[model samples]
Target chain A: MLESYIEQLQRVETLGELNDQVVALRDTLDVEHVVYHSVNSTGEQYAALTYSPEWVQRYLDEDYTRIDPVVQACYRRFHPIDWKRLDWTNKNVRNFHGEAIDSGIGNQGFSVPIRGPSGQFALFTVSGNASDDKWASYTQEHVRDLLLVSHFVNQKALELERGTDQVQTVSLSPRETDALTMLAMSYNRAQAADSLSISEHTLRVYIESARFKLTAMNTTHAVARALSQGLLII
Target chain B: MLRYIYADDLHRFPRLARSMFVDRAKQFHDRLRWDVTLRDDGTERDDYDDANPLYVIWEDTTGGHGGSMRFLPTTGDTMVNDHFLHLTDGVEIKSPFIWECTRFCLAPGAPAQVSAALMLGGMELGLNNHLSHSVGVFDARMVRIYARLGWGPTILGTAGQGRDATSVGLWAFEPELRPRLLSRAGITDEMSRHWYDRSFGALTPTAKPALSA
Candidate 1:
């Protein structure tokens, strides 16, 4: 069963074993491809995929990463996105799309954008060549499984690369915590500032400082981390 | 009658869910030419559909698909966070009380009243679950419809060039529109009460007043 694959992934000791699990996951989900690519905080990279070797080579030869809308779009997101919703405008992107489709890469794709400790960003993608209707049902049917599998993969990879004891607890200043709490409670900058009796500019400073301390991508991310870590209470 | 279908329960309603896909194919692919994939069986589905989304489905008396809307926790993967953040001026709306709604579909030949009912049911589902905001990417036409129904949502992004310009935004659960929209759609009080009464038969029914006006 697919659940067993996740259990195997947890005990995987080497990259090879981890990759085999990913392929097994792809098969279990009945999708054409499954890919996980990560760029760690230190800019070190690792990728596992089911793409053809020639396509991978061509992608590298043309440096498609620079023009990949999926990558660009996912970098700014904290959610999983459907490929159809992505903007594929411009001649180069269209050509790349055509090439990818021709290379037997599935016509339908979905990617989940993940963020981990120390500003790490990673993506887990599932793709297939089903009709829009079938793919919709397929994605709807397996999204939960995919999300669970993805986080498991990312956690295992992180453990392998940087052992498990590296957890760092982030602490924010009193003012920073106050600012984050207000933001988490759905207060706008001006409203939060007014409640704190600080100028908007001062509130901005507090938020920025908290963001730095937490290494969050944005204020929302900062608020999320603070709430999750019990650094800020509602 | 509207029913809630969580991811775990979806498998038990395969026929019902597949009907929604078929209806979506007709609406998005054949009618709107939205470049979506259509299965040989004439159903339409996408990757986001797999993410254990909460589904609010309005079914006809004959058990056919009527209208449906999908909900995802904003803390997880959502269309607004992934592709439409520009609508929020680059701000991410991440809150446990916020959910993203997408893939709203109404089967062709459904009555006009189905639209208002779908909106009311979707928002009521959010309110009942303690969700504050329901956000998603929507075309400009929906802006007019929402405004007319007194459910004016905040526009997060500006509409861009082209005939099919789309934007993202959120609809808060306040201003309770169930009664107002139902009346506007010419639905009688008896019909309205029937929906609420039937919903109780579904899983985890909330208080009727929360879904009522």
Candidate 2:
């Protein structure tokens, strides 16, 4: 069932379709809610959630992210976090939790934090009303599936945001390729130059030209782009 | 020196154990800002620590943690299997020949060689135990560190992107790679062997003599 939902998710093209799919996914999983919230590096926020429009609007109008323990905690985490583990000692936090529950946001939650290129931060969450033991068993049984779905959903969201489903290809000269590969292998400029039998100045030229071709911000960015785009095997 | 201490024996080196956990809190919670639980005593520990996992520790001159890493066999509960399966495409890494390594931490003022030395200790653990590979999940920032150590893992899969990218990788333990690791750690083969001998007894005659002094 999860696999079919992921298949349907992959076929979704527009953000609206993605939102509908999220709702359908929540129903299929028999959960109260499933949410995918992304905040890009440019500070643009996007979300596909099963929450009611009124509640979502109220959440935004009240700027709840400033006080949402889930958001605050997930921002610093790189793994799935059980809601029970969060600190709710602060009065404001307690009130926020109370309000969330009152708004039918469920009493149990699991959030997975994802960080993408250029400071893109996103959270994938599942929430439902359940006893603590039941919630623990549910999360344990479905953690892997949730994790897989989260990343793929986020990847699709990023792809749509870029307005391109196609992979971008950039060509590089042999020397440029060699330079990036050496750098990817953690070789310093001097060592790369010595290994390639080229002067350090010449290696720098190759790297600069490659960086320009890839339109990367820096050497590290260039290498990362090259690797991600399949331009460099290493 | 590299000491392979299990939880059962951790009490024997109380100072080293305490310092190791304290440094873990400093690195994972304070420095990295990871959402890890910090005890009131300021130590970062989790369920895995209770599993009696083995720890490879680099004891500094003052008998404190210089650098350390935790290892648990893939056959048991591991960080990769429990938390980061998304990076592995939901495939659990369970094998007798592969162990999981995590919680890599370094003291704030540790020397540059400490990281490499820790890697050397990991290699020693794998080779001594007849394990073929060690699996780990690390962020992109660690890529250069692994490469500089002359032993990079074969990336199984990666998630996210750029600086925040996290990957699950498998590193093969080949006898041929020992010398490069030794040079990178700046430790003589004899010294490495001595440390290994301290943890486990001297290498058997059937085992490769390269690590034997």
Candidate 3:
């Protein structure tokens, strides 16, 4: 079911369409609410959530982000967090939680943080009213699926923000890829040359040319770049 | 091969450990340009290394560091709790089932599989110790690498931007994923198991007791 949603997400071209898909996802997953909120590096904020407009406006007017433990905790963490694990001990936080509950935001929440290129930060969250044990089990069973969704949503968001549909790719020749792959596998020049049925000098030429194509400083840098760019699988 | 060496045990592999630290200095301080302290000995050492953290290192054929990562239980003072709390919105992650992995470094000419091997070693540590997750703070470039390895972490939050963007992520331990990681590292199951058992076999419940009755 989530896989289908990820497929739909990939085709969504506009933020409005993404919001509709998120709403549909909330219903499909039987969650009370789903929220995708992003704050780009330049501090531009966008949100597609199930919360009421009045509540959303109130949150911004009152600057609840300053007090919301979920936002605060999620902002700092690199792992999915259960609302129960967050610190709500402070008076301000307690009041914020109470207000959120009163606004039909539910008593339980789980959030996944997303970090995209250019310092884009986003949170994909699900909240609902449930028993502690029920919520725990729910999150446990669905964490992986939700994580995949969070990242995909963020990727789409970044793509839309950048207004570019084409993914940038660098093409390396077959021999170049083999040379870098060999180097990445920790094969020395002689060994790589032997395995590739080429002379050591020829292998060096391939590596140096590959390095130039990758704009790398050396063999190590070229291998690192190739791997990071998903150019060489190994 | 993966060698799990604690700080106290580092003396047993003096040259390998020294090379590991030197490579760390080169990667973090020189190449990445992270704000790290480099010692007069041309090595990078930090407060966490003094905490007796376990180091998972891949040794090359020459018996030097190929790639390495540092692990310390989150229950103790760790890099995330002590220095990176702001990234976590001030919440300190302290769990017996979760450890903090940091300072992942590779030698200048190390092969790419070294990274995957180091990750495999991390998974082995989690499985052997019954840990559920490992957390780390990494940069944008590492995100791509992790994704490529099919072991991307669930990011908790991020700071900075562009080339400097840093994020904290938690990696869950799924025993079923071991085979895929093994293949990625180009390591056979037998060798992986041997390395793991060599490091932790005695601690297992099935292992024979040192002082037999």
Candidate 4:
């Protein structure tokens, strides 16, 4: 599962592709469903999935998305979550869960939250019939991979939607510029620091310098400013 | 350090790519080339310069960096090139797979290293896959740069656009000569980490290895 899934998810470059992977995983595990849900910096919702026809139809026909507990809870939280952990005490939620399960969505599920700048938020989730123990193991082993996949998928989607135009709002140094560029291209700070052959502390210094120059409030804003100004190209 | 887009660098990459592309656009405009910029959302682009590879030049031999360009592959996938490059009359020309270089500019008092990096990277991307050849119009002052990099002449319809005689010079040729310097230097399909303090992420799977004393 790990090896094959890793290979398939490696080249994923859009939110659409990431959703495809989730759907694939659900089928591979012979689970009830799989879903990758994302909200961009603009709060636009994008999703790819393999839900039962009944639930999908119901969602569209009745607009259950507006009141779905999964959607509401996932948005409020900041971590990978389980469906069971959400506020399912509501009668409507219980009824929806019953309907979803009846339609073969299974009772056990897991979700991981993703964060980005400009209010970009996303959730990757899988659901299936399984013992609590089994679900726990599955998530622990694959959490890191899922987190990475979600971001790459989201990145491509953003690119497709954002296109390739930039504004100049900041001035960064070559090294600082390089560090931020690597990070912008999706390398975590640690990976970027390693690529630059400098200590993480040094990387932090460069990032701070860039952030100040851009007048950005945080690391993400600095990246945004640098990108807008054409100081770096991914 | 240098980096290439791959699968590992996904986490936090979308924002990174968006930033980098934006910065690249500004660099182009700053250099007196074409003014190509990204939209505010920072996701999609559709300007005159979209048909290019978005290159940054760095000269390691002299510790300098400046200039940027977008390299659009004519060889790898004509569809991709046309998607960005407005081939209005349609790309119905005889030449099918040709790369288009666009939105190029350099900073004032730029370093030789920046040009070197751009040249190497552009050539590498050209040779990395199938490309009929490369094409672009340049200011007369930069004509020497293109010639030094080995791009010139050929069989094609004349494209004398705009009154600037230099801008009217349209040319195309195969990348058969010397774009493979990168693969030769042992930088193949492995993941790369391009260091830019700008805000952006990775294209491939980027794993930061633990440094041991």
- Fnat per candidate: 0.00, 0.00, 0.00, 0.00
Chain B TM-scores across candidates? 0.81, 0.90, 0.92, 0.46
The all-Cα superposition gives candidate 3 an RMSD in Å to the true structure of 16.8
lDDT of 2 by residue, A35-121 (tens): 999988799989999887888998889999898878776662343567776666677877777777777888888887765544577
lDDT of 3 by residue, A138-159 (tens): 9877775676566667767777
lDDT of each: 0.70, 0.76, 0.76, 0.51
Better of 1 and 3 by DockQ: 3
Cα deviation of A90, candidate 2, in Å = 1.4
Per-prediction DockQ scores? 0.02, 0.02, 0.03, 0.01
- Pairs of residues at least 3 apart in sequence or in different chains that clash in candidate 2: none
lDDT of 4 by residue, B76-195 (tens): 223222342232112221121234555455545555444544555555444432233455544444555655545433212223333222331233333554444333333333322233
User: Which DockQ-derived CAPRI band holds candidate 4?
Assistant: incorrect
For model 2 the local lDDT of residue A203 reads 59
Maximum-DockQ candidate: 3
lDDT of each residue in A1-234, candidate 1, tens digit only: 654565467568777887888888777888899899988878998889999999999999999989987887676244466676666767788778778877878678888876565456689999888777777778777665666567668767877787545564666667778888899989999999899886665466457546645545457867876887899877
- What's the CA RMSD for each of the models? 17.4, 17.7, 16.8, 20.6
Tens digits of lDDT, candidate 3, B43-131 = 99998787567899999999999999998766446788677867654445644456789998889988889989999999988875556
Q: Give each model a TM-score.
A: 0.48, 0.46, 0.47, 0.37
